[model samples]
Target: MPLTILQKAKKLFDQKKYSQVISLLEPNILQYRESFQFYLYLGLSCLHTGDAGGASSYFQRARQIKMRDPDLLTAQAALFLRRGETDQAVEYYLDALEYDPDHALAKKALQFIRKKGDKETFLNMAETGKITAFYPKPRRTSLHPAAVAAPLAVFILCASIFGIKAVSLSVGQETRADLSSISLQAIDLKNSVEAGGSYRYILTEKQVVQAFENSQRYFQSYRDNQAQVEINRILNSNASIAVRTKARLLMEYLSEPGFDTLKDNFSYATVIQDAYLYQDCWIRWKGMAANVSAPDDRFGFNFLVGYDTRSALEGIVPVSFDKPVFLDPSRPFELLAKIRIENGSLSLLGGGIYQSVSP
Candidate 1:
C-alpha cells in the first residue's frame, strides 16, 4: 500500500521528468505524507530543478519520516557534493554505509574518493544525483517484464510464490515496521533549553509571559501572521532558552495567510508605531518605487509608503522581492509584504506585488 501510493511519482522519476514529478506530487502531499518514497522523490526533483531550499525542506521532512533510509542518505550526499562540500558528502556516504554495509552506491562512492583525484568525477556524480553515474547501467531481460504488469497481478504472483503471510512479513521487514511510529517523533529539547546557555534577559519575565500568551491566543484564533509577531519577539528577545524553545516549536504550526485570508492587517503607519509588536507580520501597503536595483535574482528598492497620493510620503522602507516583479523607478506599486525587523527599523520581503502606471 505504501509503495502503491508512490507508484506514479516513481514512474515520473524513472522517466527523468523531474519538474513534472514535482508538479504531480507536491499538490497531493496530504494523500501520501506518511510514505518515505514520496518525499525522497520530491526532494530529488527539487534538487534537480536547482531549488536547494525546497529540496532541503523536503529532505528534512523525509528524514523525520525515516531516518535510516540508504537512498535518502545517498541523495543528501549528492546534494552536499553538488555544493562542493566533499567533507559533508563523505560524512553522509559513511552514514549510509553504516546503515547498509554493502550498499553499492555508498561503497562505490568511497572507492572513488580513495583512488580518484578529480573533483569533477564527484561533481558529475552529484550533478546526476547518483554515485553510480560513472558506471554503466545493467541491462534487464526483455521478456521478464511481462510476468506482472498490474498491482493485482504482482500481488497474486508474490502471494502464490511465498504465501500471504510471507508477503506481509517481507514488506514489514523491508520498511522497518517496528520503528515506523518512532520515526516521526519530535526531538526532546527539555534538557538543552532548560540550561538557557549564555543569553541575557532582555525582556522582563512578565513581558516574555505576555508575548507567549498572546502568540498562543492568536494561534488558537487561526491568525498565524499575528501569532508569528509574538514568536518573533520571543526569538529576538532576551527570553530564557526554555521559553524561546517553546516559542520556536509553536512557530512551526503557524501558516502564512493568503491575500483574501489575511485580515485586520495593520498598515506601515500602524506598524511603525510599535514595530516590535508587529515583527514578522504581513502588511498590505502601496507606494512609489525609488532607486530600484536588481542584483542577482532579487529586486531591491526604497518603498515610498502611502506616496501614491503624492501629498505625503508616509515612510521609506527598504524592500526586496525573491519573485520576479515588474520594477520601474518612476512607478507607484502596491506591495503585499512580510515585515522584517532590520537594524532597528522595518524592511520587507515581497510576497506579492501590483504595479500601477508610471508617474
Candidate 2:
C-alpha cells in the first residue's frame, strides 16, 4: 500500500528534508487536488525550499479548501511577508490572529515588523546574536591611586593659575577636537557606527560582503523580510554601483508585480539549478535562435536558443512559439516566455519571440 501523503510528508518535514517532500507531493498534486492537508504540506515544503511563488499558489489552494484554518492563514501570511508584501501579510496575520488570538509565531512576527526604534535594537535584531555575542564586555578594572592623584593635582594647579573661564575654554576646545576626530573617523570607516555609550567600531569590507551574501541566501531560502533588511543596507551604504544594482534588482523582483520572476539578471546559476522551482514563471531572455523548426499542425514553432552568436547551437534552451515567426540564426533574438521543465530538461512553454536590438 502507498504511504499516505500527509504521513510521508510529515516524516520528511521532521527530517528537515523539504526537497524530498516537494518531490513526493508535486507529482501527486492532481490526484489529491481537493485535499487541504496535501496543499498545506506542499505549500510548506515549497516555502522551505525557497519557492515563494509555488508556496503562495499552494497556500491559496489550501485556503480556498478551508479558509478558517489558522495554520493555513499563518502560512499564507508568512509567504506574503517573505515576498515583501507587508500590507498583505499584515492583513493575513490579522485574519490569523482573529481566528487564533494567542498564535505565538504570528504575534512575534507581527511585533517584529511593527516595532521601530533605536539603531541598537535594529542592529541587534538584524544581526541576531552574532553582533552582541562578539562584542566584549567592559572590563572591571580599578584606576591606580597615582593616576587619580595626578589628575586631581593638575586640576588644582590649573584652576589656581588660569581661573575657571580659562580652564573651561581649554577643555571645550579639546572636547571639540575629540568630536571632530570622531566625525572624521566615522566617514573614513565607511560603515562604522557609534553604539552604546561611546563605543565605536567599523564593519570591515568582508563583513559587509558577508552581510549582503547572507541577505541573498535569506531571500533564496524564503526569508524575505530578513533579506530586505540586508538589501536596504546595501542600498543605503557606500557600496559600489554593481552591488547596489544587484540588490535593487532583487528587491524589484520581490516587490514589483510588473517584474518577471523567471528572468533574474544577477544570478543565472540559481535559475539554472532551480528551474523546476520556477516552473511557469515568466522570463525575458535575449539569445540567438537556431535549428528553427517549421510550425507543426498542433504544437506551433520550435527552436533552440543560445546566449550569443558564437555558440548559437551549443547548450541551447529548447523554445516553442504558438505561431511561425521569421528567424535569423546569425542575429540575436529575444524571447518572453513562461518556463517549463519536462523530463528533467528546461524548455519555454509559450510566449513571444523577436529579433534583438543588440548583438
Candidate 3:
C-alpha cells in the first residue's frame, strides 16, 4: 500500500500535479521520517504548490542527506525569495551559479536584481537633480577664425551630442554594476549574521542553510579558478580562459549575498559568511599599508556594512567588533543580519532575525 501510494505520488509529481503530490506525500513525510526521497519530493511539491514554509521544512530535511545538490539549494532559495527574503534569495542564486553557471534561473534572478537596482538609482538621481548638474561648456578656442567658425561649431555640436550619449551609457552601465555588487554584498552580510537563537523571518532557517551552501560553492569555484590561472601561468599558456572564468566566478559571487574584501598582513581576506542569506562571514587579509598621512589604523576606524552607512568605531579595532543589530519586530518581516568589512580584514557579522544558532 505504501509503495502504491509512493508510485502514484511520483506519477503525479511527474505530471506537474504538485498539489496532488503534496497531498499524498505530506502525510507520509510526517509519518515515515525515514524516506529522504519523500521529503525531497514533498519539498518540491510544496514549492510548486506555493507553500513557502512547508517547502523550506521539507528541503531542510532533504538537505541533510543531499547536501551537495545545488538544485535543492536553488529551490529553497526561490522559496525564500518568494517570501520576500531577498537576502536569502540572492545567496542561493550565488551558490547555484557557482556550481552551475549555466543555471538559467539564477542568471535571470541576478539580471533582475541588477536591472531593479539600476532603475532605483536612476530614479533617485532624477529625483535629486543629480543628472542635471553637469552643464555643457562651449569650446574656448578654435583654429583659424572664419574657416574654423562653421566647421568648429559643427564639430563642437557633434562632440556634445556624442559626449552626452557616452556619459549616459557609462552611467547606466556603472549603476547596473554597482547595484549587482551591492545586492550581492548585502546577502553576504545577512549570512554572516549570527542568529541570536531563533529564526525571526518567514524562511530564515532555509535561507541561512542556502547561504552557507552557496558560500561553499563560491569558495570552491574561486579556488578552482585561481588554480587554473596558476596553471596557465606555469605553462605559459593563453590565460584568457582562466582569467575570464575567474572574473565570471567573482561576478557571480558579487551577485550573491555577503561578498566582502578585508585587509590583513599578507593579503586581504575575501570572506563569505553565508551565500544564501549572506550572513556567515569570512575574511581574506588584504596587505594594504596603513595610511601614514592619516593617523594609523591602530586605534579608531570606520566600519561599513554592505553599501550602507559607515559607522565610526571608537578606541577599538572596528574590524574585530561584530555584534548583532536587531531589526524592528513589529512588522510582518524581519532583517536577516548585517555584514561589516573594515581595515584589511573581511568578516561576516550577524544581526537580524532570519538566522540560525547551532545546537
The best candidate by lDDT is 1
TM-score of 3: 0.34
Candidate 1 positional error at 184, Å: 21
Better of 1 and 2 by TM-score: 1
Whose TM-score is greatest here?
1
| TM-score of each candidate structure, all chains considered together | 0.44, 0.34, 0.34
Q: lDDT for each of the candidates?
A: 0.64, 0.53, 0.40
User: Model 2 over residues 310-329: C-alpha lDDT tens digits?
Assistant: 55443457777653343456
Clashing pairs in 1: none
What's the residue-level lDDT of 230 in candidate 2? 68
Judged by whole-model lDDT over C-alpha atoms, candidate 1 comes out at: 0.64
Misplaced by over 4 Å in model 3 are 1-4, 30-36, 116-359
Which segments of candidate 2 are over 4 A away from where they belong? Answer: 116-359
The count of residue-pair clashes in candidate 1 stands at 0
Error of 2 at 284 (Å): 33
